[model samples]
Target chain A: MANDHILKRFDEELERLNATINEMGGLTEAQFAKALQAVRDRDTAIAEEVIADDARVDALDVVVQEQTVKMLALRQPMAVDLRVVLSSIKIAAALERIADYAKNTAKRSIVLAQGSAPPSAVAGIDRLGRLVRAALKDVLDAFADDDVAKARDVWDRDEEIDQVYTGLFRELLTYMMEDPRTITACTHLLFMAKNIERAGDHVTNIAELVSFRNTGQNFAEARRKGSGALYTTDTAP
Target chain B: MANDHILKRFDEELERLNATINEMGGLTEAQFAKALQAVRDRDTAIAEEVIADDARVDALDVVVQEQTVKMLALRQPMAVDLRVVLSSIKIAAALERIADYAKNTAKRSIVLAQGSAPPSAVAGIDRLGRLVRAALKDVLDAFADDDVAKARDVWDRDEEIDQVYTGLFRELLTYMMEDPRTITACTHLLFMAKNIERAGDHVTNIAELVSFRNTGQNFAEARRKGSGALYTTDTAP
Candidate 1:
């Protein structure tokens, strides 16, 4: 009976941690979207808002990490419980990085707003942004339901983001080659694309964590050869 | 006496972990230089070799991480010792990411070599590579000697890398705008610069770890604004 009670408390805390991570994930996704919007619309005020909001994400990261450490130290959890704690640490780190990327995008928005050249529409950044947001959502869903299949789907979708990035890279390069004046704006766009690409990777990391939590195996190592969606055929519907 | 014996063993293992990280750092520096040389000289073989060697770095990362985990389990160390073990895990993760960046650079080198347009000289990549390599060296030195001053210096040097990345971003944008044909190669160069920028950030992470290990304080929280040179400065000597 005592053991059952202890397990119940662990499960409760795990659920709490998942809730915190999901909250952080949602905020980061919104920040990413807003940062891109700020750039596209040249909204300095929104850009500043995104920059200021990063502190919240940073603070939450510290909170989640501390909770994880406390759980690990106090509970000395094993097996699935241990994996859950470890995954939370990694997921928090990924969210923190996503916030940094969003902040960077906002900073670039400010620069674009200040620049003389009119901001041109970037071909694939918006699509990439939506794709990353979806992936993150899926990962969080998988965490909530402990659904390996959903996590697997999220991992597979990363290739679409990569393909978009590749096409965007070519387009941005062409713009830069055509006019030196576009250099500054195009560079910002490039950074934005890179940030989104990294965000996709973080989503994948979360998916992998979900899989580990379910199966008690390191999915990354077992499937290292076929892990990343680097060369998948694009059939996104 | 028993506690002293365990402490001695723990310290020895910590030393070994530090040594392995430094070795990995050295290998990555060499690989960075060779990747640049291959790109500059169109040496496909050297690029291929760099890609092949990435597996070695990856393997070392696993070994170091396992060692750290084993030490943590055995020692149950508190305070500074505990921080050291935790830092080792983070540092290993950073090193693995750096190796991934190097592999990405090598893969792009192959693509650039195969492309019809000649690989134009990129002015900022080499400099950025040098900056990242130097920062890694400084962080490792700080870890080995437990020199808080050296770690502080590493933190300060991160700004220099950010400036180089900014300059590289502008230069690459100009290249792309000048000729549509140069778009693919320039995009690769841009990714390379971003990789170096990330590697510099990892070095800062290491510096922060060193401070935490020595002082038992979370440097991320304790440090004042603009005190650690994380991402604000434009120049470093």
Candidate 2:
């Protein structure tokens, strides 16, 4: 009976952790959506809202970490439970980082909003932002459903994000080269686009964690690198 | 006697974990140094070396994580010991990220070498890169000695890096506006400087982890923000 009670409490805590992870993901999704809209529409109001909401995501990460440490100390769970518990910390950290990147874009968006930006550059960044947000949504679902296939799919699709970013990179350079007057706003747009691509990379990281949690296998050997990925990431083979 | 023996093994494991972390840090330090030199000298060979050496840091991170999980499962340490074990993971992750940023700089350095970059922009990034490396060294020492003061110092000094970065950001823009031909190289330099700033932020993160590990007190409340940090980070209190 004591063992049963302990197991019940463990399950409850696990459920709570899962729920919190979802909340963080959901908040980041909303934040990124607002951030993207702010960038697309040049809406500082939405950008400010996105900026303020980042703290909540950070707070959620703290919540997740505290719970993870408590569970590790108390439960000392082994095998799959252990992987899930540890992965929660990694996933939450990754999500917080993803949110951080979104916040960065929002900050730049405010600056971009204040000035006139090159249309092609703005449109290019919007495409990148939407793609990044879509990847975030897909990876979170992969995490929730324990769908390794979906996680792998998300991992594989990050190349598309990089391809778009590289193309946009060239376009931004061309814009600055063609018109020196637009240099300031174009510079801000450049960082904003890079931040979104970095966000997409974080999504791939979450997908990797999800795959690790489900299969208990290391994906390092099987990791695939898109050629365009090196242009931005340069973090892997 | 059996308990004493088990305790001895735990101590040995922790010592090994610490060694692995130091090894990782040393490798990242060396890698960043090479990356900086590569950028300063525009030496593709050194840049290539820095890029190739990143895998060692990644592998060391794997070692730290695996050791951390095993220690947590077996030792089930509480209080300070647990914090040390946990901080090892965070520290390794941060160091790996710092190295990743350095690798990025190296990749850009290769492209910059093939072209004629503006002298002022190149000099500006060198200064930023040096400051970032110095912070990394200080934070690592703080972690090793459990020097809370040094850790706090590193945390507080990041603003200087941000200020430098912000100044460089403007200088790059001015160069791009003045000479459109320099746009490609200056843009690469711009991202390299930002990556260096981000690396400085990771040093602050390691400093925060050190403070947490030593004081067992959360310093999130004591966090400081620099005005220039907003131009770059914008992720703060």
**Predicted structure with the largest TM-score when compared to the true one:** 2
Best by lDDT: 2
TM-score of chain B of 2: 0.94
Where model 2 places Cα greater than 4 Å from the true spot, the runs are A1-7, A217-220, A226-237, B1-6, B218-220, B226-237
Output the lDDT of residue A52, model 1: 78
The stretch of ten residues in a row with the least summed lDDT in candidate 1 chain B is B228-237
Q: Which residue runs of candidate 1 sit more than 4 Å off their true CA positions?
A: A1-9, A115-120, A178-180, A217-237, B1-9, B115-120, B174-183, B217-237
Error in Å for residue B44 of model 2: 1.0
Query: B77-159 in candidate 2: lDDT tens per residue?
Result: 87898988988888999999999998888988887888899877888989998999999998888877889999888888888
Error at B64, model 1, angstroms: 3.7
Looking at candidate 1, what is the lDDT of residue A44?
Answer: 83
Writing each residue's lDDT as its tens digit, candidate 2 over A163-207 gives 888788778878888889888888888778778888887899899
